[model samples]
Target: MSEKSKNEPFGDLMKSMNQFFHEKPVKNILQSMDDFFKNPFPNSASFHVELKEKDENYVITAELPGINREQIQLDVINNYVKITVKQLNIFTTEDENQQITKKQQSFQQSTRTVPLPHHINEKKVKATYENGLLTIKVPKEKGKRISLDGNE
Candidate 1:
């Protein structure tokens, strides 16, 4: 028997089996597992951002180390506050010519959006960063409820 004719049937068999094993979901799950094992902490660059209601105000706390004071920004909307930590360039490498052989290395640039549980006075919001921790306080607005009459 010739080699071409002997291998033709096996090639066709592989083509049919390929479709079953190369499905999108199967490929995605395999890739996810591979990434999980390679990098156990995939989101190590992101810091912790927590929000809670306290003392009639909503307090937002974040843990950020080695971050400069100028690298933080806060934006407040109607009921949402977004905290953005700009890229912190911790170090850089240069060559003999001092031409920046390698660009700056930044640990992370992350943003966290938080929705206030209660109506808050955004104008009175205050933020303070100290000891590598950022804290923001948002005062709550007063609320009044009117009695609903039982009328069909």
Candidate 2:
């Protein structure tokens, strides 16, 4: 019997329901759900990496836990080094007849690209993996100094 809502003919009841949804807590929950759906798999926003410069080469070490060497890919393109890791898991439940009743599959992948200060020879790059750590060594390209004073 309250005043009718201008936006809806369902009267004050619908207006009250709509007001409930505008509460701060409810809005925050809805916003979180919206963000999650927008990017369901927000993986590796901050992958760990370390870089060191030596006299003749550069060394890079990355921490990649619970990952196997076969699941990792490394590439030296231009003056940058790209590292990618991918893991896949499959689970299934079988009955006495060996028929899968429930099956699930999950896939995850992360990638990090690091820029080098100097040009490197990709052919001479060396990489090794041990104990969830990856180390890469890249030799710097020799530079020839040019004299500007007309001197050889």
Candidate 3:
């Protein structure tokens, strides 16, 4: 009976019914679902690393927690040192009914590739893990020592 909606299909009656149900708009609902999937999920990111030059050697340190030595890997490819780490998380929940639920998740690895200032001696490289920290030592290639005495 409203004059504003007098020519509308099913007119004022449908408008009043819509207000009663208080249904959410389609766009708003879709946006909320979109935001839910965009965040609140675990992801893989690079680990923090520190590189230092020690005379004829390069010292690399990385912070790795909640992981074992077996899960870590290192490789020298080209002129870069590739460091990879794999991590696994276990979650458990229980209620008052003495029921238990366990969930295991395998996350993507965190890696870092560092290039050395000079060519490294692959045979003399060394790495060690201690207290959640990974340390690597890369020795530089020895240069030929030439004596300048005007001697052929």
Candidate 4:
């Protein structure tokens, strides 16, 4: 084949891509993605969490802004910690005659679970939430040391 044949395929590919990008559907999809990323909270299920080990305890700090303590739930099961947040929004519009014009209700819930390398004492776990920050302290379970020496 001639060199022109090889270059023609690449040129055609580029042209097709250029046209695809200009299409309305592709443009809308791209715009939607851009708008989604532009918002800090794209979905209700997203939050930031930090987990660290400090002084024989696992400390977990989660950032849950605009949420109240009543809407948050914490659980520790099988060495896994689960944090759940549920939010409910209600909006109502009333007309001049004291009649309800429009009523809207929305509920959003998100859960985040984290696993720890060591076992934690579920009964001794402590959690506190203040100012949109949730702090959980899980105490590590004590393990008995086994000696390797052979004995009767």
Which tens-of-lDDT digit does each residue in 23-50 have in candidate 1?
Answer: 9998788889999998888866677899
Q: Decide which is better by TM-score, 2 or 4.
A: 4
Report the C-alpha lDDT of model 3 over 1-110, residue by residue, as the tens digit: 56655668676688777775556785577677787787634354667899998877889999987679998999987678989997766676777886786556757677
Among these predicted structures, which one has the highest lDDT?
4
lDDT of 4 by residue, 38-64 (tens): 885766577889999888788999999
For candidate 2, lDDT tens digit of each residue in 1-152? 33544556776677788888889999899898999997765764335889998988899999987789999999878899999888899999999999999999998778889899766678899999999999999887788998688656
Which residue pairs collide, candidate 2?
A: none
What TM-scores do the predictions have? 0.60, 0.66, 0.58, 0.71
Candidate number with greatest TM-score: 4
Q: How much lDDT does candidate 3 score?
A: 0.81
Instruction: Flag the better candidate by lDDT, 1 or 3.
Output: 1
Q: Is candidate 2 or candidate 3 better by lDDT?
A: 2
lDDT (CA) per prediction: 0.83, 0.85, 0.81, 0.88
Better of 3 and 4 by TM-score: 4
